[model samples]
Target: MRTLPPRIQNLTNKVSAVFVPLTVLLALSAFAWVLVIDNDLPAAIFRGLTVALIACPCALGLAAPLATWMTAHRLASRGIIIRSGDALENGGTVRHLYLDKTGTLTSGRFKIESVTTIDETLENPLALAAGLEQASTHPIGDAIRAAADEATTFDEIEPVPGLGVRGSLAGDTYALGRPDFPGQQPLPADTMTPNSRDKTHTIVLWRNEQPVALFGLVEEERPDTEAALNTLRRLGLNLHVLTGDASTQAAAFAQRYHLPVSTALMPDDKRQIIVDRRRETHKPIGFVGDGINDAPALSEADLGIAVHTGSDLAQASGDVILLTDGIAPLSDLFRAARETRRRIYTSLIWAFAYNAVGLTLACMGILSPAYAAIAMIGSSLIIIWNSTRGGSLWLRDEHQLTEEDPPTRSTNLTA
Candidate 1:
């Protein structure tokens, strides 16, 4: 794989560039000092050459990129696709995480519990709702489409980010989305009932700017949801849920997970909240989501993490994509990022230490140029081994392979 570096790696390169010329100047100074002190031309030149050879920047250059490369490889094997090394570093620094409600915290597999329609003349309004929602990427839309027998296609199908979808069918306008999306017409008192029951969501259908039908959906939390959130909390991340669900339902969900929440948010609202929080805290924030409405906030976050089942636009906006189902791998991702950084720091310290000792010995006439060259190569080898040991950032149990389990071992890489 090609070397993809984070900002720290770029900074390392700049430091290495400056060190090269600085080391050359120091080597020249050592040469002149030796010649003046001992009046020995051969000894002065040898000492200068030893200093330069010992201070070669190979190890310094390898320190950052090698560690990142190893970490990225490990992440890929574990079904996490990071777009760049920057995501790995950013993931480590995230102090807060904003998660979307549907398809993210809850299982996206929605079941159509009830489909009611006020239009007495219309037959099979469920099919009509499904037809309009067929083009939608939302979990609710997927459920509608899955439950319908056949969907009638529409002309000019358009999806409004946080609201719902709209299209023209048979020269009449049709919309299937949030209740307030289609028109100002009041919904039936029963259809507008508060979603007091657990795990229930609602969607409204409109025909020619009039409410026609309401669909009730039930989505259960993923089995791994509790474990994933617990792991994140243990890692010191302040969790928040930003969702378009009704306030009551949102509050209930938030209370269950013990997370702060913002309910009834549009895509723009979600994005603006992230922007405002960034200005207030000045700390890195992460957003995890898997829907069309989530694209805006995902793009606005310090790190955008999308699931494999999310819309194409969402995946494009994400810096990191979780290829596996459930967010259990999320904790492992942060852990790997921290470990990668640790390895890089360890490698750099060893590199600098090698040069410090070698330069001191060379100036004292105790180390020869041949020994200096060998020491330089040895330093680089040590860094390589440290960065790529066991070909993983963390180890996992071999006996269990499940969504809730930590990362497992994979093919090893050669240092």
Candidate 2:
């Protein structure tokens, strides 16, 4: 099991430290009441000295809530309507992130990358092929339709379940599908390999009992993938891709930028994978998805990121939501969160520093309740000012990850 951080560290107790003076003042208040009623002059004098501390400003209490509100509101500006502040920010603290493949990271629109054919032109062969594919609602069909654009001339069309479709187009009889289809095509010595199928989609095209072409459907990667991923890396965050698609495709995606991928996983299977990882480490896990199928994994993750185009339910269940159609906006999400965190740290730092100074003055009986209130209000104002400064200029750009010069996590090393 590997251990990474920004681990489950809570600032609740430390932040609660501001209440110290208030508590002491409260106890003195009780003593003062007793002294006044009991008519004890000596005790009354002692109680009166600590009475000023009761004015300790409670403004620091507003810090966390205010920061949470501002950050969430900013996220909403980008169309990521947050259900709660907890989910928006929890992503920042997460050490591990899981992303769904289709419709999430990619545009979800599958297109024909290229038509592999030994013949010169693709017109006649593709005409009959598109006719059969028109009957299906699957991604493969969508790719064929997108490529063919204007409908091909079809005379007769019939489909054989689990096999291929028989059709005639462009005044020629044709059968377009796998060799498994009736009177389709002869099998080539080598068929679609596990590796080729992963990186690109395999849609067999048959014509007249002979193999005509193999159409490979390719989904375009969102330009922001490189940038968003680089930002995560800068933060030293570990990324994982979990999807129902084949590991071959997942591996191909990973290989592009040295990513780690998981494949052939169903909805629940995705959740189980996250569950398995959880057993090995205590670090928080963040899941990213843009499909209904991702709901299970989204729910299971410590932090779930449902993209804007994702299913409504998955979006509702997710911890964080990205507004941009691509991963580019997520860089902003991280930027804002990292700033919020940094500001929180700064707020805490000043909070402690302010407390130290206030306590010193308090012990000397020089600090009054008004002064404590002023200090509390002042410190909170500073934190409020800082959290609004969110993501940096570099984060707003999409190329932060893909540039020839990989962006750096810090000022030192390049990504």
Candidate 3:
């Protein structure tokens, strides 16, 4: 599949755009100068041809793009899908990481704790809540829908960014989200206690601006979460969490991960935080998320990583999609990006060096047109080989990847 062009590739194109005309002018100058001096038409023509061939810019154009393409292909083979060359280039440079709490660091499979209804008139609050959450991709919604007997449809379902969902069911306005979610009036007099200290999240359901039901859910960390965090720490990334969860829940998650966090933030708040951090540090920032609410931050960050199981909108906003379960592959991603960049620069340097030396020799009459053509082809071949070499190494048995690791299922809905 075609991916977005890398910055280096665009630079190469721009350079080639200018270099092509300059090359033609230089070639014509060499031809005219040699003909005027020696009066040898054939020799002058050969000299001009040599100059043109030597200045082809073939190697220069291939250097960065080839290396990046190879890196992206290798990553795809390992179940990591990089949607853009810029993402691959920036992945290695991310110094700070902001991660969404739910469905990103956690397993995303929520266990239903309780579905309590304060209103006696409501026939089945869980069913109503499930109906509203049916259109939601959040783990909490999934849990609620799974527990309900059947999910009925709602009209005009609208998601409140960083909050909850609202819709019309049976000609009545209903909402489901955090207790503090706007429009949820007549708050529970008993103080909707947070059981987040015990790893549980509380969500309130409202009908006509009145509290109807509360859903308590518990989320567990993924099996590979700790290892991923450790790897990121070793890489020296400043880690933080941005979540719309309650302060108590956010604090619990942050404390568990030993990361500073911003709690009860809107989607815009998360995006603004990333913007501010980028301006202050002047460093690449990464945001990892798996929900609709995280789309804004994902799009704003320098590197946006989405889990494969995330919502379609979240995946669309991300630059990189992790197809493998958990976040362990993130460490691999950074390492591969660094390696790709190294290859890109090394190939570019080699290309430029070849052009400089080859052009000098061709112009000085030390090299013939035929030899210059051969040298030009040789330089391009070397760049191609170098670009493919690192990718080939990924197939070695020592790398531990087996035949069963499918590479063709990049768009599959699994993590």
Which lDDT values do the candidates have, in the order given?
A: 0.81, 0.62, 0.81
Candidate 1, residues 249-298, lDDT tens digits: the string is 78788778777788889998988888888887898779999988899999
Candidate with better TM-score, 1 vs 3: 1
Off by over 4 Å in 1: 1-4, 194-196, 391-393, 396-415
For residues 313-353, could you state the per-residue lDDT of candidate 3 as single tens digits?
Answer: 99999999999878877877877786788788898889878
Q: Each model's TM-score, in the order given?
A: 0.90, 0.65, 0.87
Q: Which ten residues in a row have the lowest lDDT in candidate 2?
A: 1-10
> Per-prediction count of colliding residue pairs?
0, 2, 2
TM-score of 1: 0.90
- Error at 178, model 3, angstroms: 0.3
lDDT of 2 by residue, 277-301 (tens): 7777776677888776688888898
Q: Which pairs in model 3 have colliding backbones?
A: 324-415, 325-415
